[model samples]
Target: MRLASTIRGVTYSFRSIKEVLAKANSHKSGDVLAGVAARDAVERVAARAVLADVTLEELRNNPVLPYETDEITRLVEDDLHEPSYAAIKHLTVGQFREWLLETSTTGELMRSISRGLTPEMAAATCKLMSNMDLMTVGAKAQVVVRANNTLGLPGRMSSRIQPNHPTDDVQGILISAREGLSYGCGDAVIGVNPATDTAESTRDILMALDEVTRKNRIPTQNCVLSHVTVQMAALDLGAPMGLMFQSLSGTQTGNEAFGISVSLMDEAWAKMKEMTPTKGPNVMYFETGQGSELSSDAHHGADQVTLEARCYGFARRYDPFLVNTVVGFIGPEYLEDGAQITRAALEDHFMGKLLGIPMGCDACFTYHARMGQDELECLKVLLGSAGVAFLMSLPVGDDIMLNYQSTSFHDIPSVRGLLGKRPTPEFDAWLSEMGIWDGGKPGPRFGDQTVIR
Candidate 1:
């Protein structure tokens, strides 16, 4: 589909230009054409410089640039221009461990160092460290930041559930949601990727979810992941703006194709702020993954992780309620194996926390990526310790529509038990009232099993 167009004589497509343009204009009745036209003009100019020499074929074939070790070294050295530089230079690894354990400001120091290195370098350095050391750093890196919303989304150091369904089937969506909630999940938000990607379909799903939430008395946000234009149409049609969803990337060209810019995002944020249910936290939900810039033909020779951090910086401007990095979802082309995925997930959480953004990790992989459940489990535990804000809720760890395996309903209690954490405050109360959770522990039910006489 033609995902982006510019008046500067450039066009970009996810499939074909006709298909994308058709989808873009499908909500003309809602007056989305004007917004699309304005976005096209801004994106055309923003993308012109990046596409000057690179071909779309090159971008597709070479999604990630080769890492520059020398450049990374220079950047790391430059970043040590702070008070912590002396301690880092003089302390032995053991002494560093002791110091990390002894000091309250280690998180501040680690955040500074993390901001200094590119994600590639951070991953490489972490691979050589022991898991204990990694965990120690990650645990200390947790800062008490909140998204400031009513649903109490991510009010603790625990993970939230994101049970996503294929957009076409309302019944199937509710079924998945019920399955997740039965396991005491969906504290993050019960969201779906709409099949039709139209305003009517999006509105229908949102309204359905709202009704479900009210009936069940689940203290969570409801969302249908459609294009922003389609979502605006749904809002115009009186759909509750419970959760405003968007996928963003680092580069200007990428944001353009996604039909987002600083101005556009600000506009959306204002609209949601004015209309969202007063009883919930902030209404914005954003999904970002590394490699999106390259996928959109917008990489400017920066490392994927670096670009991913830039995307977080952009999202922070809006003070979004939830920001999730689909850490390994892009595939092996960007991150080669389980170890790479693990490090990338840690780096994303660490970086996002340092940036003061409420962050979550979709610790998952595609089948072709040669990753497995064991790798996902490893990353999940590490992120759980790192105090990630939330996780994806796939029934039994498998997403039928997205074709990936992520954290499952069963994984929630497993991680919380390991960390002595519970779901967000409001959801925890709801779970307790439902007799699904007792005193911050999973109720008598476990996994896919039910009791019998």
Candidate 2:
């Protein structure tokens, strides 16, 4: 479809070219036609560039860029926030999940995100962070590929591909390549999730990323390195829970995961101490997800009025790489019809901000096979700004494409500009200073872990 659109554009450009040439025979008409031709020619080139997969930065940064931002700027407006738009467009699942977690404590976040209501529209222009975060690599990947592609790259894979096979490494390789590409593209601060169970695993993931850079020839500048929650569960180590700590410590994976989750988190300084070796401006992400049942119980310790302050407090103190949280509804319509009404009531009537709301792309509903037409994918995009996190969802691409898009490429962040060089040691020092290592809290630390009876 994208190709078809480009081809159609090229055909139109040619038609304009002919008209311009014919008009060139006359002096006055020729000048206007010539200008039109010049514009058309540039548009033709840009259309082709899109076919080749251009980045937002490329399109925006080009001095001679043909298409003006205004051409598509209309798509950037509030109507894009409409539920109808999101129901039919691209939806970013993971980023949406992240946003919910980030804003869970910010009472300012929106709620009743089911459908018919656009989170972005509900918020004002002061709410720019949502779009900013959406511009990140993760968000771009989601919007560009949709949910269909397996590898998170341009093309799709066959069912015959095996996991251990080279074909199966698509997601990891794409992640590594995108990280390197992002660095080359001026994204210096990289967010990484190392789901390693051991020291060797962490080393392996990092080594793999380094290999991607080396192989792809990406320049290495000082960048921040933040460690996500290490694999700390009994399942992670193939051990049972409540076992003596020493009994499981002998295993490499067991020790590494344990170290990060328990000791590193227990002591902010110790956490920072271990991160020092990475030479980074490090941030730790402690993510937690309560099952559908226990999730309701989350945030009980914090009052509605203090949610924002508390969440921000944790974010400021820990300065995490990213916070991963989750909020799921009983049905997809939870966001659209009635949900929107409830949200309006909370905001308009109560003047309340519901944290951990989902931002959704319009297409999420139709593409999600699990739900019928009445339900839309209840996803939200959250941005960290104004000392309060904002949750907003806009319709971009569709469900058929969500998976595919996610695996196809890195999502672009909302912030535009080249990545600034930050010493990795800085990140490390920050983590250490936060007492994330020795005194860091361990998991099941993040999200709601309590199971329902």
Cα-based lDDT at residue 236, candidate 1:
86
- List, residue by residue over 206-258, the lDDT tens digit for candidate 1: 88888878877777777888887788888888887577889987667778778
lDDT of 2 by residue, 101-213 (tens): 45342222233232222222212111112323323312222101110111111211111000111222435433433432321221222223223334344344444444543
Q: Indicate the worst ten consecutive residues by lDDT in candidate 1.
A: 25-34
> TM-score for all predictions?
0.70, 0.31
Off by over 4 Å in 2: 1-199, 214-264, 286-296, 301-309, 321-453
How many clashes in candidate 1?
A: 8
RMSD in order of candidates: 14.2, 24.0
Report backbone clashes per prediction. 8, 101
